[model samples]
Target: MVVTHRGAQAVGRCLEFGCGTGHLTRALVDRLSIADLALNDLVGDCEPHVMARLPAGQRARFHAGPVERLDPEGTFDLIASASVVQWIPDHRCLLRDLSNRLEPGGWIALSGFGQDQFGELQALGSSASAPGYRNAGDWAAMVPQGMALMATRQIQTRMYFPTVRAVLRHLRETGVNGNAQGGWSRARLQKFEQDYDAQFGTAQGLPLTYDAVWMLARKI
Candidate 1:
C-alpha cells in the first residue's frame, strides 16, 4: 500500500514499526529502494530474526522497544506499520507523533484490524480484541491536521477450520489472541465447542473472520 502512493521510486529513509519477523520489512525492501531503514518492535529478541531477512549489506538499524518510547534521531520519508497500530491505545497521540516524525511529502501507511475483526470470537465472549479497532470510516478522522488522507481500504475475510479447537489453536499460533484468558475445564471446553459449532459452523467448517483496514496519508 505504501508503494502504491509513493510510486515505484526510491524512498530516502524509512521507518517501520512492529516489523515482526521482517515480513513487511522484506516486502518494502523488495518493492521500494529505501536508502536507509529503521525497524522497531516491542520484542528485542526479534532483532536478529528481522535482520536475517534483510538483503545482504542492507543499510538498516533495529530499535528494540515499544514505538511509543522510541525517540528516533531524525525524520523519515515513509513511516509504516502493518497490523501493529491496533495494539496501541491512543490512536490520536500515535498518529500525531508519527506525523511529526515525517519529512514534508513523506507518507505514513498503517494497517490494523477493524471493529469486526474476530467477530465470532468476540460474540463468543472472548476479550482478546485490540483496543484500537475502528471501522473504515473512523480512520480518516484520526489523521492529524498536517497530513492529507490519500487512500483507505477495508477488507472482510474469513478462514475456515475443522473445529472450534482448531480455530482457537490458529489464533494462538498466530499470536492474535495473546490477551485471551485461560482456565477452561473439560466441561467448559466442551460447552464452548458446542456453542461455536451451533453458532458459526458451515458446510465447509468453523469460520473465523478477519476485518483488516489500511490507510495511507502524506505530510502536507
Candidate 2:
C-alpha cells in the first residue's frame, strides 16, 4: 500500500524511517524509482542488512538513531515507515516535525499499531509499559492543518500461535519486545500462559491480536 501510494506521485529522494532489517526498504526499492534512499533505524546494524538488498549499483545513505533525533541534510520527496511511530511517545509532535521535512506535495506513508495493537497482551496485563497507542481516528485531530491526511484506515487481525511461547518469540523477533522488561520468571510465565489461554485461546490455538493503522498523507 505504501509503495503504491508513493507511486502515485513523482518520487525522488526518499527517507525510510525504521528500516529494520531492511524488509520494507527492500520492498520500496523493488517497487519504486526513487533517486536516492535514506534508511534510518535505531539499530546500528540495520544499514548493512538493507544495503545488501538494493539493486546492483543502487546506493543509499544510512542513519541509525531515534527518528526524532535524526537530522538529514535536506528535505525529502517521501517519508515512509512501517510498524513504527507508536514507539515514540509523542507522535503528534513527531508527525509535525516530519511534515516540516517534506518538500511541498511530497508524500508520507506510515503504519503503526493502534491502541488495541496487542489486545491480548494488553488484556493479560503484560503490556502496560507503554499506553499511548493511537487509532487512525485519533490522528485526524493531531495532524497539522498544513498537511492533508488521505487514505487512512485501520484493521484488526489475529495471529494464532501454538503456544504462548511462540507469541513471545514473535515479539522478540520483531524487536518490539520492549514491553517484556527485566525478565520473565517461571511463575510469571505460568501465570501469563494461564491468562492468555483463558481469555484469548481459540479452536485454532492462542490468538494474538494486531491492530494495524495505515495512512497516506501529503504536505501541502
Candidate 3:
C-alpha cells in the first residue's frame, strides 16, 4: 500500500477502491491536493474513520458495496487499489470495468498477494479440504487483452514469530483468519492450530511468508 510512484502531480479527481480502514486513503489525502477524493469499500462501517482522517474542506465521498455496483458519475484521473482485489471472484470483469471508467492516460496501481502468500497457511487449509487460491500469474491472465502494463514486481516478506500462538493472534487481530462460509468449531480450531504448528513451526518459532505483487498499468 505504498506509493511507489507519483506521476504529473496534476489536480484532478482520484478514487481508491477497497480502502480498508482508510490506511492508504489517508495517505493519498495528505499527499495530493486533488479536486476530489473518493473512497469505496464493500462495507459501510469505515465511513467515520475515513472522514476523521481526511483534511478539513477536502471534497470526499464514500461508496460502500461491491465495485461493480458503484455507479461513478464521471471518469477519474487515477484509480488505485491495494490488498483487496484478490478476494473478488471475478477480477477480470472488474478490471475491464475499471479500464472503461478511467480517462485516457489515467493510471491504475494495484497490490495484492500471490499464490505463494501464506504458503504454510494455505497448505494447512488444503490439508483441511479447502481450495481455490489465486496467484499473481492468475491475476495477470485476467487482465484484458489491450491494457498497457507499466510495471509489475513481486516481493517476499517473512515474518518470524516467537510462537504459533502469537502468529494466530496477529491473524485474528487483522481479521485474516475468518472463513467466509461460517464459524469454526472448537475442535476444528484446535486441530488447525496443532496442524500448523506441527508442519511449519521451527525451534526458533514460526515463519510466515507473504508473496506480494505490485502492479501499475494504464488504461490505454
Candidate 4:
C-alpha cells in the first residue's frame, strides 16, 4: 500500500527502524527503488538476521540500538517502520524527530497496533500492550509540524488457538510476553485458563485479536 502510494520514483536514501528479522526490509528492497538502505533494531544480535535477508550483493547499513537514540548522518528520502510505533512511549515526539530527519518531500510510513491489539488479553486484565496504541483518528492528530498526514487505515484480525496455553505460548514467541510476570502459580494458571476458555472459547478455539493501524505522511 505504501509503495503504491509513494509511486515509482526511486528513493535516494531510506531508513527503516525496528527492522526485526528484516520482514519489511526484504519487502521494501524487493518492491522499491532505493539507492541506500539503513536498518535499525534494539537487539544487536538481529543484525545478522537482517543482513542475511538482503539479496546477495545488496548493501545496507545496520544500526543496533534504540531508534530513539540513533543519530544517523544526513536526512533520508524515506523513514519507515512496521508494527513498531506502539512500543514508543511518546509517539508524537518520535514522529517529530522522524520528520526532522526527512528531506523536504520525504515520506514516513508506519504500522502499529491500535488500542485493541490484544483484545482478549486486555479483557483478561493482561498488561501485554505497548505504550502508544492509537487508532486511525488518533494517529492523524499526531502528525507533527511541517508534515502532512496523507493516509491512515485500521485493520482487525483474529487468530484462533487450540487452548489458552497455546495462546500464551504464542505471545511468548512473538515478543509480546509482557503479561508473563513471575506470579503465575499453578493454581492461578489453571484459574486463568478456565476463565479464558469460559469467556472467549469457540468451537474452533480461543480467539486473539490484532488491531493494526497504518499511517503515511510526507514532510511539507
TM-score of 2: 0.92
lDDT of 4 by residue, 1-220 (tens): 6777789778899999999899899989888888899999999899999999998777689999999899989999999999888889798899999999999999999999888888888888877778888998897778898999999999999999998788888888887545554577799889989989999999989999999899999999
Q: Which candidate model has the greater lDDT, 3 or 4? A: 4
How far is each candidate from the true structure, as Cα RMSD in Å? 1.0, 1.8, 3.0, 1.2
Considering TM-score, which of the candidate structures 1 and 2 is the better prediction for this target?
1
lDDT of each: 0.90, 0.83, 0.73, 0.89
| Backbone steric clashes in candidate 1, count | 0
Preferred candidate (TM-score higher): 1 or 4: 1
Candidate 4, clashing residue pairs? none
1-220 per-residue lDDT for model 2 (tens digits): 6655545444689999988888888878877877888989999987778888899877689999999899989999889998887777887788899999999988888888788877788777785335457788987876786898877899999889999988888887767657754478999999989888988888999987788888888888
How many backbone clashes can be found in candidate 3?
A: 1
Top candidate on TM-score is: 1
Instruction: Specify the highest-lDDT model's number.
Output: 1
lDDT of 1 by residue, 1-220 (tens): 6766669899999999999898999999999998999999999999999999999888999999999989889999999999998889899899999999999999999999898999998899877688899777888889999999899999999999999888878878888667764677899889989998999999999999999999999999
Q: With candidate 4 superimposed using the best TM-score fit, by how many Å does residue 215's alpha carbon deviate from the native?
A: 0.5
TM-score of each: 0.97, 0.92, 0.85, 0.96
